[model samples]
Target: MKDRKYNTTEKQQTRKTIQRNVNSEKINSKENKANNEKVLDNKKILIISLVVVVTFITILIVTGVFDSGVQQNVTQMNTESQNSTVNMANMQEINNLENKIAANPEDMESTLHLAHLLQDSGLFEKAVTNYKNYLIKNPANADARVDMAICYYNLNDYNTAIAEMENALKYQPKHQIAHLNLGIVNLTARNMEASKEWFKKTVEIDPNSDAGKRAQELLTSH
Candidate 1:
């Protein structure tokens, strides 16, 4: 009876141990499934983060604000450069004009321009020389003779100025400038009668001109 009772108790204990082992394996499988779910969630979050970063970068590119700023900077630089080039071109043109005048000493137009430049610079002696050279080369030029007379008058050589006016008059007696300049020279030299005669002649030459009207006023005034 005691042996039978011991065998029955041992069999029950072994069956209980096997049941505990089966329950342990089921618990381990549940834990593994939870860990796999967590890993899957992490992979999904990583993919979402990558997509967000790529989309943000794409948005920045699509806005084109950065490109506009770059374009504006380039345009501003180009405009400044073009302005500088224009300024340089203007300076070169001025230099070229000066060079042309210097290279052609005997050119009538250049000589005239140089004389005016010298006069403007207060270089009276050089201005006179240039005007005299022009006159010598272009003796038939009535306007140049008048210009020379003006230069001589500026140099205080009234007698030579009057002589030039007389020479211009010989070419065309009705020349208004010649008459007006002669009248002015005579008045400066204190020859009242000669001044009167030339002023009257200027009025007769061009009654519609300002010089003629002024000459008429001077003739009547005194």
Candidate 2:
């Protein structure tokens, strides 16, 4: 009976030991599972943070590029608008000049005025046509010839401009404006020596004249 009781006690202790081990194992398993979940959560947070940072950087880059393009487009549009306004004003003035010419084709004064206006407005080709017509009516108008030479110079016809200026000098030997303009044209053509000579001639023509003052300035600059 004592042996049987000792065996039963040993069996009970063994079962108790087994139960303790199983409980400990279950607790360890739960802890390990919780730890794994925490690690996974940390990894997910890191991945989300990287994605947010990359997306923000990309947005900044795209926004900067868009702003620069918008600014350039705005500047170009303003420039075009300003140019259009100026062109409209020039066209109106040209239309008025044409109307006057149409009304009185034989009026040399109006014709010459239109030519001068056209020249001042940078319409060199039209100015040249009108100037040629004026010269046809008044062949010996040295001033008109000089004005035509200026149109030629503006048109980049340097040789023809020089020839026309020389013809003006033939008609009026001491024309101060013609001499000054010759100096200017030669200076533009990079003929420094000829420019100096013409400027000197301008000064000699009339020291107190506006043309003379301009010539003196050019000479001083050189």
Candidate 3:
């Protein structure tokens, strides 16, 4: 028997079977490698997501974004303390004012009242000093100016008294007392024209005023 000769069909069938087995094995190995790689990728993604979430939470805590509530409480406490201090100071000052007003010589009451008492006691300069002090603190005190003008009147400083009275009247246009008093002070200085004008205004503004009655009394003498 000559060496058995393989036919083309048999040779081809053999090659096909070998090639199929090799291809099948290559396909299985590639599938296993791909599955392993996919699992690794999934694990890496999960770890990265966890890290990002944790970092975001840490940043929020560190930046004081979470401390707003605590800061508000502290602010409220400070404000309350300031208000308490102010209220205490006001109470103390008001109490002192009441005590000061109830006493004598050194007692400071209404600017007008204190100055009037000192003037009546014949301390012209001292009365003037007190009125000046009062005016310094309460410059718009009309009642105090009236008393100050009277003090000047007693000092025979008719010009000063008239000026102070005019300042008082400027604040109170309808001040019947101011008009009447100004008229008399003008009369003593023989400012007849000014006195007549003031007396006429006093009569028109408040005919029932003591100043008006005083003017009428003076008229009867004239």
Which scores greater on TM-score, model 2 or model 3?
A: 2
On the 0 to 100 scale, the lDDT of residue 27 in model 3 is 99
Question: Tens-digit lDDT track for model 2 on 160-193?
Answer: 9999999998989888898999999999999999
lDDT (CA) per prediction? 0.82, 0.92, 0.79
TM-scores for candidates 1 onward, in order: 0.53, 0.58, 0.49
Write model 1 residue lDDT over 1-222, tens digit each, in one string. Answer: 899889999988988998899899899889999999999999999999999999988887799877888999999999999988866765565456458867876577877776666665555677778778877877777776777787788888899989988987777767798899899988988989999999999999888899999999889888
Error of 2 at 44 (Å): 32
Error (Å) of candidate 2 at residue 125 is 0.5
* Candidate 2: clashing residue pairs, number: 0
* Count of backbone clashes, every candidate in sequence: 0, 0, 0
**Cα shift from native, residue 134, model 2 (Å):** 1.0
Best by TM-score: 2
The 10-residue segment with the lowest total lDDT in model 1: 89-98
For residues 1-222, write the lDDT of model 3, one tens digit per residue.
Answer: 233355666778999999999999899889989999999999999999999999998998898777876887899999999988866765565445435655543454554455665676666776798788778767777778888898899999999999999999878888888888898899999998898888888888867777778777665554
